[model samples]
Target: MKKYRKVSREFSKHTINALRYLVKKKIISQMLGVIAVGKESRIFLALSPNGEKLALKIYQIENPSFKQHVRYILGDYRFRKLGSTWWKIVTLWCSKEYRNMVRAYRAGIPIPKPIIFKENILVMEFIGENYTPAPLLKEKLPQNLEKAYDNIIKIIYNLYHKAELIHGDLSEYNILNFNEKLYVIDWSSAVNIYAPNARELLFRDIKNISIFFSKNGVKIKPVESVFREIVGESISQ
Candidate 1:
């Protein structure tokens, strides 16, 4: 509890307001603890009044390099203009993640289910068991690298073909491995597959996955070949 307060102190009044809104909406009855912290957001483990576990992600807008965050927002048609100030940008960023998760989840892609969003905060289904968050794929290597790699490729294919989206930051760092099932998290960086830079982003995502699995001794296909297969394009070479 003391540690959570110490961390909450870093949040702005805007962030506090968002959390209060979640409680007011009955999305979460109380916050349990900080589950994870990243460069742009801090995730909290919370519970609904009915005892359902939820994950609350609060976006931090006070970062100096917030301008760099615009890259992901500008390309997406859903949020063409990234608001005026850093705070607004961060708020819209929160909403973007929620919407992206909804689209992917609806398409049957394995992603954290978004519950709600207010300002710079987003509530979603917690991805873990017994209040214990799942470890990132980067945190621990899977027992079967081949199976993990195949699952990841299938996820990429579904995200593109079915969801019509490209995970701009797909890598081991953003994927969670629970009971050998892969759940791709962090939809904030995803862009529409039809976006101008979607091809590049898709290629980079495939490259990151291929490199990670190759390093782990998985006999994966070439990145370009994988990209071509996913996008259904003929490779020049």
Candidate 2:
């Protein structure tokens, strides 16, 4: 497999071996280059055996803040038992993201389609063209701020009422503006509606989006009003 740019060497040998396993399985043909990096993971642009573009999100095994993720996992009914080790925790976190993406995609949310996940790596549909990632919403705001604001609100509503999931972290940073289309990314922090902290997370998600749009002159409704419309109840109710 050919690697393009030099990525962080902090990746564990286990993650390197996992990449080899995927190649052997014919799941990915080549690793083009690093697409983006985040606090706990690195995203790489890759190609499938059929030459289709894919995004490989590899969670860092040695992430110092891996412990902070325990709250998201513990309240998730899907993950009843927490992992005993850091590697295990990161691996489960990767799997959780894959499952969350599947749920959101199936529910008609505009998210990258999750292909598969192995170990600490998650393979999904590439959201950009020609190995270049789409600009983030914060980087390039759409021309029609009103439409963009409405679209995001619909996504949040569907995430709650349809997918039964809460995007615990929803902000311009994690949202992509691809040719004026909005695609929400980063699902590891998403939690089910019944999660213990779901209400708080959902409120925060709505508030983040509302704050962003309002600041950009979208004339958004109050955060509580939007939250109540989605969940069918006031935040304090």
Candidate 3:
């Protein structure tokens, strides 16, 4: 929690900028609640003037040591050639996540739809209902194993083939099990299948996912098979 505050402070300038942009753009006004203070972002549950609820993610670019943070985030291929202004890189990185989320949502990948993205703030569809956060997959394992396994496999296939993306941080931590349906969040680490390190990222995602599901009582294959299927041998791991 303290870490989140420390990071959020980095976005002071960006947040102020986004707020000005949002208000100027006539986006949102009412405040409902705060969802979570994640390691890298602060999430808020807000209400619009018309009384519709929404989720907003505020990204932090400070912490001093965040210079190398890009190595860990997903979909970095888009802004690799951009000059090395740390704030610019970080801001672009957040924007990249928003774009990926929009793509995923369009491909029916069960990701939150991006409402708006400006500077470091991203507004998205709130995944929860009734003022509660949709439970993380870690906290909400399914009672029916076969059905859940099939759902997991289908989503992985969709994200891998149909969406042409690999969710690099696809552990239970990033999956929301809402009302018995699975929704993926935290796309900051998602990457295109053709990224230079795509195979490596895909393999790690598979390992993280399989390990998490197995611990939750669903057995899955090794990362190699997933890599072969998703990345193909010609991609060069």
Candidate 4:
């Protein structure tokens, strides 16, 4: 129970009810433990009644950085008319992440399959074996550097062209290296390609990936060239 205090403290009445609802609906049999914690959400390792593993991400309504989420939500046409309350904002944020993951999954990108979401809680496929969470790219370096870089690039290209979305924040920290396969996580910051700052965000994402691979001894092309290949245009300096 002590290990769960850190996560339970962040759950509000609404989130508590939402979790209960998940249990009632049999979406999850029981929560196993906290897998990870971020500034805005806590990831819990959970189990299904049928013996399947799942990841539960519950967003904190009182997150200090709640204001930052508005930028991502405002540009998302689906939630354009979102209310201006704290609860409304955070719930919308959770929805945004679920929607983005669905888009990426349908695009054939390597990502956790989104199962369901309600209010501030989201359930998805767990990415690991035997209840152990997979390590981030920053923690576990890929064995095939060249192939890894190429695969990541392909994901980026498909994300933009096929899904019409851009991962606003892409870095080694947000990508998971599971069994030599790359899975991009943390889609809360992703935005539609038509979002106001989409181009800028896309450029930043490309630069981040390019820099990471370069440091890992993979000689990649200039960021600008890769960006051009992705977006099919040159941005004026």
Candidate 5:
């Protein structure tokens, strides 16, 4: 574990400062170490003032690599006017993720509990036991493909019907395989059902999952049926 360092709270500040701001905001008190430095966000193991362990995800403002986020953010109706600036897009992306996660949580979907979020810092409940992040589904394929496919399908169902949302970008990468269960993560691209392109995104999400499961030998019906069943709307062939 790396020692926790003090830094600035704003995105203009170094990443450490951004983390410090999260601590001061009571989003997290301190961090044990960095977990994963991903493309969009860096994950860290932190401590609450009350001593509970938390996960801090700091979105890089300066030098924020939004190379892959372009498609999803541009697709959302809520993120219009995010001009060509990279930081502006990153800020909006984090806000979207926090809002979507909160909505999903209220609807009883299995999402990480969001603690607090600033312009770019997001503190959330850590899914792992000590410090390690839960492995992604791509890393840890479920031993039984059938059960894994079922779990993912159920999650998609709840996300649409209960949360009234669609994960605009989802795949094995955004799904965590932990404690013999499937936990959805990386909600930075999730969009509400009222979004203009919500159904298209949902169909894409289901199709990706179906493709993965099929490759693993789990039989799945067409993505169409899955989408209709989840949203409770019949569609023409």
Candidate 6:
């Protein structure tokens, strides 16, 4: 087995064991390096035994805001009966992201294909080249902003109508722009359409995307109009 990077020591025992399990099962050969870090998780670049690049997202077991994550999981019927233990919650959150990605990918949404998840670690298709991650939409604005804007709107529509989910935390930061193609990421906070605050979350997602494209010189419909068009009801209604 290849030696892990120095940063590997930061992972929890469960995470380390999970990685070992994946290696033993030939799911991934080894982790290359950290690709990105967020408040509650870290994404690592990894390789499969067949030399395929993959993204490994490890949710922090000791994340201080685990309590806050309850809101997203609570209203989603699929996980309603899950336990409240912190580790279990983190694991559930990781599973939520993988399942959300699977739904989006199956719906033909531009997203990383979810391979599998174990404990709090999620392995998925990497969206970059040669161990370099794709630039985020915020980092590298596309030259054709108009087309990008349209693509995002269409993705939002499909996610709602076909996938039956709403990206609760959609923003440029979680979107990748690789070779002028857009792929949504960080789906841990996404919720089903039947969630209590689904409409509010969907509206916020639309508003965030609309504000971004409009400020970047792309003509965009009003946030309310876009929201209503997707949800089939006015925000006020």
- Computed on alpha carbons, the lDDT of every model, listed in order, comes to 0.85, 0.90, 0.73, 0.88, 0.77, 0.90
lDDT of 1 at 174: 97
TM-score of each candidate structure, all chains considered together:
0.93, 0.95, 0.86, 0.94, 0.85, 0.96
Candidate 2, 49-117: lDDT as tens digits = 999999999988988898888889876889987889888888999999999999999999999999999
Cα lDDT of model 3 overall? 0.73
What does candidate 6's lDDT look like per residue over 1-237, in tens digits?
545545568788899889888888899987888889999988998889998999999998988887887888887988876656888888888888889999999999999999999999999999998778999999999999999999999999999999999999999998999999999999989999999889889999998998899899888999888888898899888
Location of the lowest summed lDDT over 10 successive residues in candidate 3: 1-10
lDDT of 3 by residue, 56-130 (tens): 887766645446556645345575565367667667767878988987888899877789888878898888888
Tell me the tens digit of each residue's lDDT in model 5 across 31-56. Answer: 67678877767887778878888877
Candidate 1 stretches greater than 4 Å from native: 1-10, 234-237
Off by over 4 Å in 2: 2-10
Better of 2 and 4 by lDDT: 2
The candidate that wins on TM-score is 6
Q: Rate residue 228 of model 5 by lDDT.
A: 83
Q: Which scores better on TM-score, 4 or 5? A: 4
Candidate 4: global Cα-lDDT?
A: 0.88
CA shift of 221, model 2, Å:
0.4
Between 3 and 6, whose lDDT is larger?
6
lDDT of 5: 0.77
Candidate 3 regions with alpha-carbon error over 4 angstroms: 1-11, 72-77, 232-237
Name the runs in model 4 displaced over 4 angstroms.
1-10
Q: What is the lDDT of residue 235 in candidate 3?
A: 34
Backbone clashes for every candidate come to 0, 0, 1, 0, 2, 0
